[model samples]
Target: MTSTNKESNGSPSPSDSSKGLWRNLQFARMFIAYALATFGDWFDALAIQVMVAYRWGADPLIIALIPVCMAVPGILLGSVAGTLADRFHKVRIMLLCDVITVVLTIAILFAPNAIWLLPLLTLRAMMGVFHIPAQQALTRQVVSEEHLFQASSLNGFVAQCSKVAGPLLGAVILAVFSPQFCIVINACTRLISGLVLWPLRKLVQPKQWEGKGLTGQTRTETESVLTQWVRGWSFIRSRRIILTTMLFGCFGLLAILMIDYQFTTLFRAIKPGNESLLGWLASSVGAGAVVVILLLNRLPQIGYGWGLGGGFSFIGIGIAALGWVTPLTPEIWVIVWGLCIGIGNGLSMVTMNYLLQKETPPAFVGRVFGIQNSLSSIVLVVAPLVGGILIRSAGPSPAFQYIGMATFMIGIVGIVLQRVLWAEKKSPVAALQE
Candidate 1:
């Protein structure tokens, strides 16, 4: 691990050996490609929603079901996908998925109606189920353990940039063109990601059978895909800290992701019949994340506990204030609150991801991330429906307030958990795992 020093102001500074994380040529290529892909996805999503709203006049439930449909494949097949990432070359999996995305994204363009697009969207989600674990595992391979947090921050930075760039771009294109144009842009982005990543095939190192023989391995190696998936699950079950963190993080996100399902309605509450404003407001959240990612090196030295707990707290405070804001209030304040939520979201997500990569056995990193996806799938499935119902019954404001309160309370619990479950001293696996 490269040893880090402090800047004059006392913030953790990138080590000379690691200072070039963002400047690393290999990573820069991958990150840019990944960001382009993400930007396309977000833009496509917004374009689809706009299409649905205009073409079909989708109700709240219909709006909510989009994300739910997207989550279904991850719930059912995420573990299997994780196991596959471990079994195969991760870079190949990513390239293959990106290729698949090019084909699948085009299908959305051909959808004659909004109803036809749902299934195509679900197919794209299925590709994501495979792409995510591979992406996480590959990220672990590219950077050093000491620089993991920084690497994760860079990744989040790209993601946040997408969130900012995507919708705003979508809004502009949608104004001039149709949903088909957005879909074409998404398909082209995938092709671009593939072209960018194709040259990096030599960069991703292959897994070594460190202690295993070519032909002496057990029958389990030759077993069915189901058997391999069970192995992935068994690995996660043996890692209690990773498991616990996954559960807690998912539970916390369950409270927060409601925002995604209800965001369209909530944004509309601020200014009805306006779509471009929604893009700008959505960009505000990403703008917050972009700030954090850019200045990530200057953030104070903090333990995983403080990082995670603080993130939760920020998100809670932001959402609560977001709910409390009225139409009479200035819209800038709403953007401010949304930015808070995005910052918290980026911090906790990236920190926990760093912890997971640092602690997990290299062999099982793919599977663990897969199981993490499954847990998130569960939250995504339930939260959207519940959030949509809350918006329908109690209205978006109260829903945001109540749900944000729940997250705020969870943040408090996370703080306590940080003290009790995590160590006063460091341990490699989730801060306390042995």
Candidate 2:
């Protein structure tokens, strides 16, 4: 690793180094496992959606149910998953989920009836509900606190890479093979992911909490799932900044979902003869995310300031591009929207993950992230249905315009709040303490 330094207030600052990606062997294992798992996830999603659309002649409305099914589980089971992550050895939970998912995928391959499709998809989604929080919690356990930001950035980068490659590979596989075969391949990926994760069992040591004897037993027995679900909100009540960030995230998620629907519909409208355009557009978005991730790792200072601002700007521009859709040049508009939204999502996701890791204690990180995931899932569920209704009545252009306007308002609010916080830091009372 190389080294550098910063000086502040006549004090010598710590030197910077490469952060030595290989320092945490267990973290690397987890990253590889997650990347492989995501590849399978993305592949299954794209392949199944296309298969259903082609074989069953399903429209966008029906296909939208696929995402809805996946998100529904997160909304319902996220808190439970978080609680489990906190209580158990997270690696064990993750490995178990992986095995369950693989079995479910194999079952889907063997029983390939349209009637069985929804149930199989729902089961897969349920496995994901457990897998995500466990994986996140285990990552924290494996790496040092100082390396968390970079680890998160790298994880985001790998996941985006999977998104880019998975769909394209899936499309190819579908051209030559059946959807059942794709399901089998997805199972194979999960199996390999599980194998990779098996070696990290030692890293996730279980915590031993001191018991309060009968009082603890009584409280445990009396606690309900609803109480656990609301615990995240209670924790966030005092964290004004994080709460505001989550609110911004909700708008960002809404904008992203709107663009997703618009992209699919627009591609179908513009080049209905060539469905490959949808995959290409999705790949473009993934490419943009990859670019942002790389830049963030290479340029930390810029990532902390302008990179964050640029991300929100990209989101605003992306939403505006969606509103500009015209039949005359829809492809160009789709690409532009993909680029902007991709960059925006990449920047926002990495920064938010970093902030959460920095501010939250290890014991509560899982619950906090679970809440964030659930909130995003809820927004996603509502966005498509509402977007579909708007498109039906007002037309796609106006629907997109409405989404864009709302996103821009949220971004403005975030910027204003940031400035207020900055001003407070610069005030005389704050300065005197310094």
Candidate 3:
């Protein structure tokens, strides 16, 4: 592959230099399935938070447990999930995940009290831990290297867009039906995503699933999961591009998650009973992401260090600004500030991911991303709990300020990583390598 894919970046992969507006049919199908599933997840997210806060009378600490419960399993089990994704048929893994999700969503409907929400959400999150690595690995396998950047960008945009659409859909649902019904709607969407993937069954199988190497040899594959796990971890440790960006991105993820778990609280703090305002604030993020997605080809053609560090710095500024300016101070200020956060999220996340994908091989994609996801979960797991406590003790306004500052600190970390990478560039071997 070339250094840049002109369709998404400024150039193209060596294999397919021609430009195209859409990924091939196979990738397109997967996108549809994924988008449907992501929308469901967003809807469930909004419903759960609203239910926990309004229906359960959950304090910030208790509500914080919801995201914590969902994330902790990723930290604990993501390695296994990533390895399994490589070993198994990714399509089957995705299908099974959806099936399990449907079952779990129904289980939530029958849950006797809000206490059950955490455990159920945790199970669903774990299922996702398996599904996501597989999907990422599978996408790399199926999509052309030339199209990967655009495909990844489009997929990322879809996921973020769902965050906008799902919450808005949830707002409408809550307006008409009980929050419990949102769980049911989510379950149905999961089923839809699975059904959509059914057509790819015969075509989506990779060599790894057939007990062979990616190159189609009856290779002596590592017999032990432990060995595979170690290889994966070792790969993550060795790649400065992956390792540093993963660590730096944590701050942005933390800031975003804090806002995620605390959105209702933030909105209510501004104006209680303004249920739809949360959607409006959340939608602004999608708006910002849309701007970047639309301008995908126009982004500065820079090296990974500059692209990732500068992008993260931008995200940090936006997030910190949002935290510093609480909603109640001025509603328009909060809404407009959300656009900044979203734009940062889009630019930083897309750039970092593209860099990671460019560096990762098909064989290691699952494990590398698995480690990345797990590392991210470390922040995701802790941010909500700490944010809850902060919200309770410091109130949403100050709590938000703290989250924003934490995110801003990540920008500093990114700059340092960029400098270190630039210094390493003098070494021809590593700099010359992918």
For every candidate structure, what is the RMSD over all alpha carbons to the true structure, in angstroms? 6.3, 7.1, 5.9
Tens digit per residue, CA lDDT, model 3, 116-202: 777888898999999989889877777655566777778778878887788888879988998888888999999999999876665
Which ten-residue region of model 2 has the weakest summed lDDT? 4-13
- Which model is ahead, 1 or 3, in terms of lDDT? 1
lDDT of prediction 3: 0.71
Local error of candidate 3 at residue 183 (angstroms):
2.6
Best by lDDT: 1
Tens-place lDDT digits, model 1, residues 1-434: 22211111111234433565664545666687788788888888778888788877877667767877898999998888888876777778889999988898887777777578778888899998999888887776655556677777777787777777787788799899987798899899888988887766655342332111112233345656676677667756665667667877987888887777577787688667556656565677778777766776455224677667778888998888878877678777877887898788777877788778776655567788888888889887787667778878988889889888888888888787886644543433333222
- Give the range where candidate 1 is weakest over 10 consecutive residues by summed lDDT: 2-11
TM-score for predicted model 1 compared with the true structure: 0.84
Which candidate, 2 or 3, would have the higher TM-score against the true structure? Answer: 2
Q: Of the pair 1 and 3, which is ahead by TM-score?
A: 1
Candidates sorted on TM-score, descending:
1, 2, 3
Please report how far candidate 2 places residue 256 from its true position, in Å.
2.5
For all predicted structures, in order, the TM-scores are 0.84, 0.82, 0.81
Could you tell me how far off, in angstroms, the CA of residue 168 lies in candidate 3 after the best superposition? 0.9
